[model samples]
Target: MPVHRVRFASVRSQRDPSAPAPSVDAREAAEERLLEALAEAAGADEPVTALAAILEDADPAELPLTGAGRTRAQWEILATLGARSLAAARVLEPHLDALSILAQADVPAPSGLLGVYASESGGVTLTATRLTKHDDGSDTWRLDGTKPWCSLAADCTSAVVTARRQDDGRPQAFLVDLRHPGVDVGEPAWPALGLRAVTTGPVAFDAVPAVEVGGPEWYLQRPGFAWGGIGVAACWFGGAVHAARTLRAQLHRRQARADEGRGTGPDQIGQAAYGRVDRLLRAAAVVLGAAADAVDAGELDHACGMVEADRVRGTVAQVCTEVLQTVGEATGPGPLTQDAGHAQMVADLQVYLRQHHGDRDDARLGAALLEDEHTGAEAWW
Candidate 1:
């Protein structure tokens, strides 16, 4: 039977016709040009270098930010779509997200410090890194410990890291110069199956000089923290979109061969797979859009922001996983084994989605919801 003869057509065409179409002319001409440039540069041999060059050429002040003119949700859509275009390009998304959060949080950054947020505390629970304030009558801080999962560790000129203060033992945000003496960017600890181009590893800060970005616990307490978390989901969604494209291309090729009477069309199973991926993508998009809208409306400035961000993160993570599985099963090993880009995208996305803290995050959201109910503030409809 023809692929279109399956229920996939009806399922895909179920969009509400009465709903207004999303605006395509949202970005300014310059922004559009920058996006095009980034897309082209994303395919470069060194994507990080290309990203840095693009950032240097573009006016940092004019760069897109959440809640800046355009709807925050729309910005997320654009961001995810951009990331989806190139798997390697996903590396730049986190830095951009950090920049956006810093701006939103009103955190002061040192001049000429290219920001990469390296606040991953994955291994810190077992072994905490301390950044003590050096009370030498001078405004200097010393970092001593190893930070794991430092993405773009080597490429970033500076990074915002969370280190416990010696004064009070509270985790605080600090800006550290990657080039500073005693700061060691360790060997590639990310021996994962994907995201090889975006080098991440353990960074050892041996009494490295650092400047505080915000007060103790300010990094996690800030609204931008939650916003930044949701932005990660945007990147995941982008990666999933790319994976979906591989499946789509495979289906198209099969259909073309069928049209030429040279091969069989997509089977009912293939159509079902496509439908599943479509539903996952659409659901993830809706969650992201809602989160973006919340951010734009300043709903993320309170406890609600954390809940909403958790929702987006969890939803996007699930969608990406489903996309990976569905696309893999639907297209078989052809794309994974033959298409380098598809394979890399799959690998990159798999590793990236692992950033989600799984049940811990879900538990946090659940507890928050329970607290909301106790306070009669449960507005999660």
Candidate 2:
């Protein structure tokens, strides 16, 4: 079959002839031009570069939100899915998430630098990284020690990290430049079977200059924290959708083969699998949409917001797991072994879904629900 190419940029150009073309890097410009030519190609390639160019051309402040200007949380679900379809969500989602966090926290980020959030502090155990405020009369802050699970550690130009305050032992968020002196991006430690492109590893800060982003404990206490948690679920949902697409394609191929006397027709087992996955995905979408609406309505301003976010994330994670099992069983090992994209999508979805905290999160939700019930608060229907 001959591939038809459709350049997305050309469509925009045709719509607005007088729109000014923003200046971009020569290499990026060349890549965009090439992609424009390949838009109608049977297999569109270089989705990461294409998406990056589109994002760069727009002002970060004006990105659309999901659900009637509901917080960016809802919009993230669609964005993540689009990136996942191109097999680039692992590389792009974190950078976008960082930008969203900074905007929510009201942190001023310089234009064009990719931002990362690396605030995993090992729960109760203090992270090796520590932020110290010197007695010397200056606004200077210094970061020292090692931070683990720093995604995009080497690639990000800047990061928002959590460290224990030397003065009062409170955890605080600090913005630091990766290019500054005394910052070392460690060798990659994320050699897991999936998300190889994410590049998560340790980062050592040796008196690296930084500025505190918010007040002590503000990062977690802020409404945006819950909003961000739900956003991760959106990415998981997107990846799941991509995995489900493989199963749908395989089913179609089997049906076609049967019609041509090459294989059997769709059977009861395939029908059941399709039905279950369809229902699960639909339910998940509803939950995500409701959560997005709640966020936009400022429902996440209190404990209820956390409850809703946790429920949505847990429910979505369960749905993704079910979809993975259904797809694997119905399609067998053919797609896993024969299709590279399908294999990558399956592996990536499995790893990314682990972002959910499993029993811990469920327990938290259970306790909150019980508390609400005890207080005679309105039942969370």
Candidate 3:
């Protein structure tokens, strides 16, 4: 599929490698260009070309892993992608997460985009059976059954699949090449308004050839799980940032209209809403940034890992939810109806942020705190 490539103006903002340090200003300037390019690309009738440009430039493979003392940079790269295009972020993030998963076991994934299809929803169950133990002490395996919520399953060249052992019924992670004859990419059943460019659905495996990535249950048990979750929260934060940016843009134009010629503008009546959106988004940013730092510090490696993930995801999701509502109300229907960029962003965020389980996750956090006896005054902090 053809995609709209970013214009030279956008790539020019990327700082020269040998010129100087990639200071905060340089990063922000480059990110600003990316955001603009994505906004321009979102309305294209092509494939994910703008996002592909980002991948080419960012080199997601070389990105630092979580808890690698540079986790902030990793999350920031994802956040920047999310800010302009969640559909792009939706497809790109899994590849990055899958790479991190492979890196955990020092297993090399097949070249090209990858997917992480572990969710076993819709009453489907994938089972893995050991096929043969090679003389090199490597065991070949096969996967059977269906995995659901597989975003870009058809597009990915390979995937890190999670399947239960046929004999012991224990979960295990396996690398499956999607091109296998036994692998079936289901019909595109994605019926959603957001992230539509990434057609997510179920995939069936019938004795698909595979290789294990790590030991049984290693996928979720790894520290990268929580780190990955936090990374998604950072995406949520970035999505909200876009919504806030939209709100700000709308208010400024109308305010200028009121100040000069056309007195019919809201006269900055929506400024308060913009203020709320700004404050909430900034707070969400701080929360995610701090969470990235915590992951790198190894503070959330094992102890209360899920709790921190839930907290950060929940906080960012809430901020995004409010931004959606606030921006919609503040801008009224003008932007939604007239501006394709603003409308597409709102719709995309609505679907993307739904990945968070909302109150269910909050209940889990409460239950975890109670069960762990983690009650204290400073704990409130």
Candidate 4:
């Protein structure tokens, strides 16, 4: 099917209440179309360039507009695209293309750069080092540290990474190719929670032949950091939106039956939970939308500094947990048996939520909102 047609059809699918909400397959098809359009425009067959364009152009709001706020449109776009990562990674097979695309967009193709590390001890310890040429034109450098919890490392060809130069002690970023002789990818080690399909493994590189990105001095200045955060945030946001929609459907379906006096629908707890989940997603949508707008406006510095990425991550985290709890209670074992979609969504959300767990590094968000006390701390309105 043509990409445009698929997208249109998927949109139409939304109208039928009984129809399953868009699945990972639909998300992947849409992403494939996007990748094709981007590849054609960059005039480069390399997947990195194409991936970069899509990441750069994507409207984050599409994924999961959280609130009924001013940014509804933007969140919708982000949630839609965010839902496709697993599917995208699956279809883009060989991992190089997807990894390269991620690196180009600065999304941290964890394993490719050096290696991805799982937080669990059973996971392999993967590391990447940076080598740089100093001002004296001599090849001298420093070695930075390792990052844990790399998602999608099992198949990435290379990763865009951050490291410190050993010689002079400066931060640097590199695109580490997984095919390099020294690169090693560990077996998948993630304990299932969500997003089980995407390989969350460890990659280890030992004194590998490395290529330097730009000049060593320009390393810390890379925008890839923000992009990486945004990518993960988008992916999580997508999962959350799917969860909300799925739960909402089940709730309403039950409610419909209850209305016919069959019992089960909108109980007080379910009603309250549904309302809370809706509000959470709505707020997430607004915040993520603003972040995307800031990116387009070239306000990346501000966006990154504020709770830009966190808004997406945090909101999704809360909503996914709440929705799953609510829907699971309302449907009981019925959803578990009859609706694989709900179960899958719950699993995916569990895994995706883990993305925000370990090294999210929210220090900046804490500092940014220190002065805005009231609005920042409150949960409602």
lDDT of each: 0.69, 0.66, 0.75, 0.49
Q: How badly does each model clash, as a count of residue pairs? A: 0, 6, 0, 44
User: How far does residue 20 in candidate 2 sit from its true spot (Å)?
Assistant: 32
Using all chains and alpha carbons, the TM-scores for the candidates as numbered come to 0.83, 0.78, 0.85, 0.60
Q: Write the per-residue lDDT of candidate 1 for residues 233-317, one digit (tens) a residue.
A: 7777778777877888888999999999999989999999999999888887777766666676666665777888788799888
Query: On lDDT, who's better, 1 or 4?
Result: 1
In lDDT terms, which candidate is top?
A: 3
lDDT of model 2, residue 256: 98
* Candidate with more favorable, higher TM-score: 1 or 3: 3
Quality of model 3 by C-alpha lDDT: 0.75
Residue 121's lDDT in candidate 1 = 59
Q: In candidate 3, which residue pairs get closer than 3 Å at backbone N, Cα or C atoms, i.e. clash? A: none
Order the candidates by lDDT, highest first: 3, 1, 2, 4
**How much is 8 displaced in model 2, in angstroms?**
23
Q: What is the lDDT of residue 242 in candidate 4?
A: 58
Model 4 lDDT per residue over 1-381, tens place: 222110101111136788777566665456455544533432344434344445445543222222212122223333454443333322222232233234444443343222322142443332334356569654433223344555556444455545555646555545566576665666777677455655665555666554455556444444434433554555466655555666677778887898899986677877777787777766655555555555545545533433555655565466567666766765578766777655665677665566565335455456545644642432223
Model 1: per-residue Cα lDDT at residue 214: 63
